[model samples]
Every structure is written in structure tokens, then in C-alpha cells.
Target: MLMHSVSGVLIILVLIATGYWLTVQGWFDEHYSKITSKLVTQIALPCYMINTITTQFTRGHLLKILPDLQFPILSMTLLFGLSYLVQWFFQIDPHHRGLFKSMFANSNTVFVGLPVNMALFGKASIPYVLVYYMANTTFFWTLGVYLIRSDGQTHPGFNLWQIVQKIFSPPLLGFMMGIVLVCLQIKLPPFVESDLHYLGNLTIPLSMFFIGMKLAQMGLRNIRPSKDMAGIFLGRFLLAPILMTILVLPLTVPNLMKAVFIIQSAMPVMTNAPVVAKLYHADSNYAAVMVTATTCFSLIMVPLLMMMVMRLV
Candidate 1:
């Protein structure tokens, strides 16, 4: 598990570096990033969610998934709330406050979490990955989106209609559809399923490419971690995982599922946090720095934590 976790993160690092090189050599540009954004947000991610769910759905898997999501979602939502509460005693600005809490709460589950579990536990890990995915996705589109949008002067606070729209995003919609199909044990047509899965395969590399482009757009100078960003680093890498381990204490799932859930919980901030930060007039450079720094550091932190988990579990 430890070795596989290390190898998994290394693979992601290589992809990120590849994208960085592409950006440096002018193979990608603003237009390329925009296109990649649209592709993942609208197409690839949705398909990916559906493919993962349908491919791995089984009676046993389905029974465990919904019940298992409770702890991670509740714990993360609380951590997000606790982060916001922490800001009250300090003099943090509105923009940085929201960015910090959002980064602390969400994880790069689809990219880092999924692959890490696969590497550590092999194909059976998909179902456990989905548990975290469903929980993280729910947190992200709701409170997570609200955090980014809070910086926009024109954006209103906590509108139900907006929440409805956010929750019904392409990826969430696809995931929901997958739940329907799987619960009913209804399979898609073989031809369509094959194509959807093929499209889904584009998500990981494309997401990394998008991140690299954002880093390029922000310039390498912006990657420096600030003191505030370091606080978020501790929150994400240390506090979040500890919280998850505590949260999972009462759940009687397999050791592997518990390990994967906590590991996924401890992942770096969501890749799209900066993208939404930019969209919603927040401190995007700050968000980008959080993403990059945590991502690079997690190469070391995640494997170490997995080793710890292996010993205890």
C-alpha cells in the first residue's frame, strides 16, 4: 500500500509536470485552458462519474456506499464550518477567508483520491473511491461553490435557486443518473456505455493539464506559499485526515475502505477551487498557490500517512 501510494502520486506529478512543460513550450494557451475547462466540467467529468458508478455497482457495493458516505460528508462539512468559525477571531479579509476555508474543506478526490485508492487497493477500490467522491462532490458544489461566489459583490448569499443550479451541474447530474441505473440494476446499451467510458478516461490527464495551464496563467512567481497558505496546508494535510480517522471510528466497514476514505479525505484541495475562485472574483492566485503547494507536498505526506494507516489498520 505504501509503495503503491507513492507510485500513484508520482504518476500525477509527472502528468502535472508534462502539462507545465506544455505550457512553457507554448503548446497550450488561454484558449486551451478554457476548452479543457469546458470539456471536463461539462463532458468528461460527468461521463467519468457515470462510468465509475455503473462499472463497479453491485448489490453489496450499493448497500455500503450510501451509508458509508454519511461520516465523510458530515465530517468535511463540519471542518468547513469550523474553518469559517476560526476566521471570526482573526482579522482575515473576506476573500482570503473564503478561499482558505474552501481549500481546507475540499479534496482533489477525482484526481488524487481515486488514483491513490486504485494503486493501493487495486480495482475493488473503485467502490470506496465512489463513497468519497459522492460526499466530496456534494460538499463542493454547495458550500464550496458558495465560498468562491462569496467574493463576488454581485453574487447573493445562499440562494436556493442558485444552490439548485449548482447541485444539478453536469457531473452531479451524471452521478445521480448513475445511482438510478445502478440501484435499478439496469444496464446501458453496450455501444453507448463503451463510448461514455472512453470519454471518461480523458478526465484525469485533462484535469492536470488544466491545472498546469492555470499555474502558467498565474506565473511561477505566484506559486510561493504565504503564511496563511501554510495554515491551510496544515488544515488540509493534517487536521482533515485526523478528523476523518476519528469520524470513521464507529463505522464497521472493511479496513481497506476505512483507510481509503481517510486517505481521500486528506487529499489536497480540489483542483477546480482556483478555477471557481477566478470565476467568482476571489483571490485566484491564492487559491492556485494552495493547490500547487499542497499537491507537491502531498507526494510526501500522503504516502507517509498511508504507511501509518497500514500499521494501525
Candidate 2:
């Protein structure tokens, strides 16, 4: 277990180190990183998510989640509170609290979630995870956006259309199209599914490399890890998932579902947290620290936590 954890951590660190070196060496510019993140978010993530959702939301699949949504929601909400609690305890400025809230609730669902799942469970678990992420996307963009508006900033005025816009955003639209395909009972020819499988698999490494690129852009020099930052790291990487695992694993969740939920929770703070922080004039630095520390730490924490969960189950 320890070895597995160490290997996972080392791989991620090496990727980051390589990325850092490449940027320092001027192999890629910030424009390159932006394009990479854009491709992942606008193209790769949506396609993979749509492919998974189409398969899972089929005739019999949609109604089967009666009890399943509970744990995910509970876990998400719990982590949300814990993250906010940290901000309050730390006495982070009112401005930064929103960023802290995002760190607690958002997670690295793509880069870390995909690779870790394939390593710990298998390709079969990917569809279930896609659903979880699809749902998470909605919550993160909507409620998360709302939280960051502060100091009498004109609230973007609650807009359901905006939420729908997020859902219909390229990545999510793919998932929606998948659902339509499933409902229409149109199976992709074997060749297409095969193509999807091949393309979808690229999600893992590409996303990881994107993380590497972001870390390179931030680098160690730009980020000074503060105690408040450390708290967000611990909360996301260690504490929140640990709390979720205890609640979800003991329930009758299938081993695969349990693994997905637990591992997803274990992912690093969501990249959007910082974006939202910057948007609302919150503590973007704190959000950046949360991103860096959690990204660095989750390499070890995720695998070790997975091993423990597997053993307990």
C-alpha cells in the first residue's frame, strides 16, 4: 500500500517537475498552457463525460440511483462546510472566504480522478465516475459562482439560464447528447465506441500533463504556502475524503461505486476555485496555494487512501 502510494505521488511529481523544466527552458509558453487547458475542458473532458453518461443513463440505468445520490451529495456538502469552517477558523479575510469555500467543495475530477480510477479499479468504473462528475459540474459552477460574489458586488442575479448554459457547455452537452442517444436507443456502432474508448483514454495523461503545465506556470517561486493554504490542502486531500469514506464505504454501495466516490473525494482542489477567486476579487493567492499543495499531496494521499478503502471493504 505504501509503495503504491509512493509510486502514485512520484509519478505526479515527476510530471510536474518535467513541466516546470520545460517551461523554464521555454519549451512551451503560457499560450501553450492555455490552449492545453482549453482543449481538455472544451473538447476532451466533455466528450469523455458524454460518452460515459450516454451509457449510464440508459433505460434501466437512470432509475437505479435512488440511494446512490445520497452519499455523493452528503459528501460534497460535508466537504463544503469543512472548507468554509477552515476559512472562519483561520480568520481568512472576508474576501478570501469564497475562495476557501471553493477549494473545499471543488475537486480535481479530471486529471487525478481518471488515472486513479483506472489504476485502482479499472476501465469499467469510468462511466460511473463520469456521472458523478457531470453532477458535480453543475453544482460547482452554479452554487460556487454564487458564493464568490462579495462586498456588494452585484450578484450575477440568479440565472437558471446560466446554469443551463453551463450544463450545455461543450463538455456537459456531450453528456446530454449521450443521454439523448441512450433514450433514442441508438447504439454507436462498435467502431465508434472503439474510437471513443481510444480517445477517452487520452483524457488521463493529457489532463495530467495539463496539471503539469499549470504547475509550471505557477512554479514554486510564485507560491508561498501559508497555514490557511495548508488547511485547504489537508481538508481536500486528506480530511474531506476520509470523512466521506467512513460514511459511504460502510453503506451497501457496490465496491466500484464506493471506490469512485471515495477516490473522487480524494482528488485535489478543483482548478475552478482559483478562477472563481480571481473573478470575485477574493484571495486568489490562497486559492493558488490550495491548488498547488493539494495537487502535490494528493499523489500520495489518494493511492494510500484507496488501498485502505480496498482493504476495509
Candidate 3:
């Protein structure tokens, strides 16, 4: 299991490296990233998540893992409070505070994290991954959105319908529907199911390609960690994972789910950080740089952490 898991992480790193090289070679640019981002967010990811929930998730699985949601909720809630306190103590800039809080609290759970979980724990791990997915998604859209907006960038502000739309996003709807279907035990026809399985498989490679394109846009030479950046790194690569793992120790859930939660919690910053930052008029460049740094670090940390988690269970 360790060897296979490590190999998966290595393969993902290679993809990042290849994407970097492609950018240098002029094969990827801003346009490529823009298109890929749309594809992943609107199509591939929703398909991947919907397929996973419908096919792999069951009432039994949900019943068993439901209690485990608090791990991420508590860990993120603690880190968020700590992040805010630290930012306040150090007097972080108003523009960047929200980005910093998000960097610490919410992870790239659905996109990059899901792929890694697929690699390490396989199809069966999706239900467990969804635990983090649900929690992180909740924090991300609500508190995460608020932090970005709180940077005091003028947004159109919130409308009740808009908030509802954001909360019940396509992926979340896919997840909820999957639960409904699962509880009723309705299976799709074999051919249709096979097609969803195939279409959903496109998410991993597409997501990695999008990351590579973003790396190209940012340029590797430009990535230099500042004091705040250092804090962000610790919150993401080191503190968040360690804290999540420790919190999971006493959980009565399946051993593999515990490990899955730890690894998912440790995933790099969300790929959408820059976009969200830009929307809220925050420091988009800082978001991009942090995303690059933490992602590179995770190539090593995620696999190593998984190996340790395998021992703990």
C-alpha cells in the first residue's frame, strides 16, 4: 500500500513538472488555464463527484462516516480562530487577511485532493473523501467566501438567492442526489453508469493540466516566500495536516477513512484561490504564489504523511 501510494504521489509530481515544462515551452498559457478551469468546474468535477456518490456511496457508508465530519469542522474551526488571532497579533494587511485565513482553513478538497485520494485509496475511498469534501465545501462557500469579501473589496454583496445558488452548487447537488438515490437504492442502467464512470475519469488529468497552466502563468522564478507566505505554508503543509491527523486519532470510524481524512486535510491550497482573491479584490498574486508553493510541497508531504498514517492505523 505504501509503495503504491507513494508512486501515485510521484506520478502527480511528474505531471506538475511536465506542466511546468510545457508552460516554458509555450504550450500552455493564460487561455489554456481559463478554458480548463471552466471545463473542470462546470463539467468534469461535477461528473466525477456525482459518479462517485452514486456508484460507491451507500446509506451504510454514509451512516458509518457521518460522525467523522466533525474532524474537519473542528480542525478548520480551530485553525481559523488561530489564523485570525495570529493575523490580528501580527497586524496582517487588511487586503490579505481573508486570503490568509482561507489558506489555513479550507483545502483543495474536491479537485487536487480527490485525485490523490483516488490514487492512494482507490474508488472505495470516495465516500471517506466526501466527508472532508462536505465540510470543506461548507466552510469554503460560507466562511471562506466571507473572508475573501471581508478583505473589504466591494462585491455585489449577497442576495439570498445567490447564497442559495452558491450553497447548492452542481457538485453539492450531485452529492445530495447521490444520497437520495442511494437511500432509495436506485442504480443507473449499466451502460449509462459505465459512461459516467468514464467521463468522470477525465477529471484527474484535466485538473492536473489546469494546475500546470496556472504554474506557467505565475512563472516559477517569481515564487518567493515572504513572512506571511511562510505562515501560510505552515498552516497548510505542516499544521493543518498534523492537527487533522491528531484529531482523528480517537475517532471510531474505519481506519482507512481516518487516514484518508488526514491526507485530504493536508492537500495544497485550493487552485481557485487566485480567482476568489481576484473576485474580492484581494492579493491574487499572493494566492497564486502560495498555491504553487504548498502544492509543490504536498508532492512530498502527502505521500510521506500517508505512509505514516498507514502505520498509525
lDDT, model 3 = 0.73
Q: Per-candidate TM vs. native?
A: 0.89, 0.74, 0.79
Per candidate, the number of residue pairs that clash is: 0, 1, 0
Model 3: per-residue Cα lDDT over 105-139, one tens digit each: 88888666776777776887887788888788768
Tens-place lDDT digits, model 2, residues 1-313: 4454345456655665676677778887767765665565566656676567665566566656534766767777887777776777888766666666766777776556766776666678776676567656656755565565442254546478754653355555666677678767888888777676666655655555555555566666767757667667767777767777788766766777877887787788775554444444555445655666777777667657776667643
RMSD vs true structure, all candidates: 2.4, 4.3, 3.5
What is the Cα root-mean-square deviation between model 3 and the actual structure? 3.5
- Please give, for residues 93-172, the per-residue lDDT of candidate 1 as tens digits: 76587777778788988778877777777777787787888888877866777667676646456668876876577777
Query: Candidate 2, TM-score vs. the true structure?
Result: 0.74
- Candidate that would win on TM-score: 1
Q: Specify the highest-lDDT model's number.
A: 1
| Model 3 CA lDDT for position 225 | 61
How far in Å is the alpha carbon of 168 misplaced in model 1?
A: 1.7
Candidate 2, residue 64: the lDDT equals 67
TM-score of 3: 0.79
